[model samples]
Target: MTELSLRTRESFDAVMRKYADMVYRLAYARTGSTFDADDILQEVFLRYIRADKTYNDEEHRKAWLIRITVNCTRSFAASAYNRHRDLSEPDENAGAEDPALKAAETKSDVMKALLELPEKYRTAIYLFYYEDMSVAQIAKSLGTTETNVKTRLSRGRDMLKEKLKGVEFDV
Candidate 1:
């Protein structure tokens, strides 16, 4: 049993290393802030460690992670603290030297336009373009139909195109 537990721990660590970037990017895309994304990333992994459920395969695990990430970001967005907080107020903890935020700020115009979109649209676009999730897969992850996902992609594309007409980035 000890050996089995040790293997489980190793597996968890491996999953963290493998999925950390993907999870972080998803969280960042959803929250539009480095600090919020990092918080969501940590919470998602913590829940992963504590959850009683198990994943049958890599796809299952990835889907599970994405679902949890979306939930975390949504909860954060809906929280009373966030709802009452001032949007223009700077994060007291995110000092000028935060490289993660600096990197987020340096994203291209296409990325900037994507961030300007509504949360659902940003998520659909991110999952489709950056994460390479299919429309059906995104629909499953988002608890919506494939048709809804396609609609979101179409609307998001229109918004992006309008915002990025002169920008030279592939859609």
Candidate 2:
């Protein structure tokens, strides 16, 4: 177990180095602001450090971290909404300067459309497309059946297509 501790620390460091950007992106997609996403990332790692010992396996640990991140983002959104008495708006600079910024801008329009969706559909779409989770994984993460995830994904995509019909894309 002593060796495992060292290996876990090494593995954790490697994972953070490799996937930190991915985590931030996921958090940003969920929270819509770099500042809030930064906070969420920190909170996710803190939770990971204090996580249960049973998640000794790497895959289990990664899933646990993602779950914590998603939960924290949802909680933050709820609290922000309660405090402001309005839906938190997406940051205007949500997509700024990546090579794919133009494509992302189109997607951001879709995301804005997604913001109009009920939380269930919004989360399903974000997890399925942006986070690339499978329907089964999304269902497990959301505590729903895979069939429900599929239904939500379908509905969300249709809504996005409808909302984006007239949006002009630069590219």
Candidate 3:
């Protein structure tokens, strides 16, 4: 109704449109389950909206979202419900040809190998390569040292190379 509210609404919509895919992809990369990723995406935005925090720039806002995503995924993975789930149950759609997943998995072999890496390395690699973020940016987002991020990236690349030895995928 008011000008201030209208401006806030427009900004919120813009932020959601700009970063929704990035948040979802990061969540999916972390959880390996679309359902969980969806939930994490919702949680991250909810926090963002509720925090009502101001950012210094677009990069700061992006980094904040990344940090929230990482925290939300960690919370989900550590939840009692997740811990007690039946891990033996087979993924129903594991062999299904899902078009959405097909589109997302541009280089299937590379994605598969990337998912196999440790979470620390996987997060680093995803932010660096997939999100086109610098090591310094990732360090700030993850609240870690740049040296640590570099180490993770180096180790992640090596792990992917080993896993996709016969494949034509590059890390």
lDDT of 2 by residue, 28-113 (tens): 66655566777888877766666534555655555666677778887887785545645555444546643333444565666567
Clashing pairs in 1: none
lDDT of each: 0.82, 0.67, 0.81
Question: Best-fitting candidate, measured by TM-score?
Answer: 1
Runs off by more than 4 Å, candidate 3: 1-10, 85-107, 166-171
Decreasing lDDT order of the candidates = 1, 3, 2
Which residue pairs in candidate 3 collide? none
Residue 131, model 3, lDDT: 96
lDDT of 2 at 144: 80
**Which of the two candidates, 2 or 3, achieves a greater lDDT against the reference?**
3
* Residue-level lDDT tens digits of model 3 in 1-171: 222222223477668767899999999888776777879988998898888777766777888999999999999988987766666766555676644456456748777777778899999999999998999999998899999999999988788879878643344
Put down candidate 1 lDDT per residue, 38-77, tens digits, no spaces: 8999999998888735666668788988999999998998
- Backbone steric clashes in candidate 3, count: 0
Clashes of each: 0, 0, 0
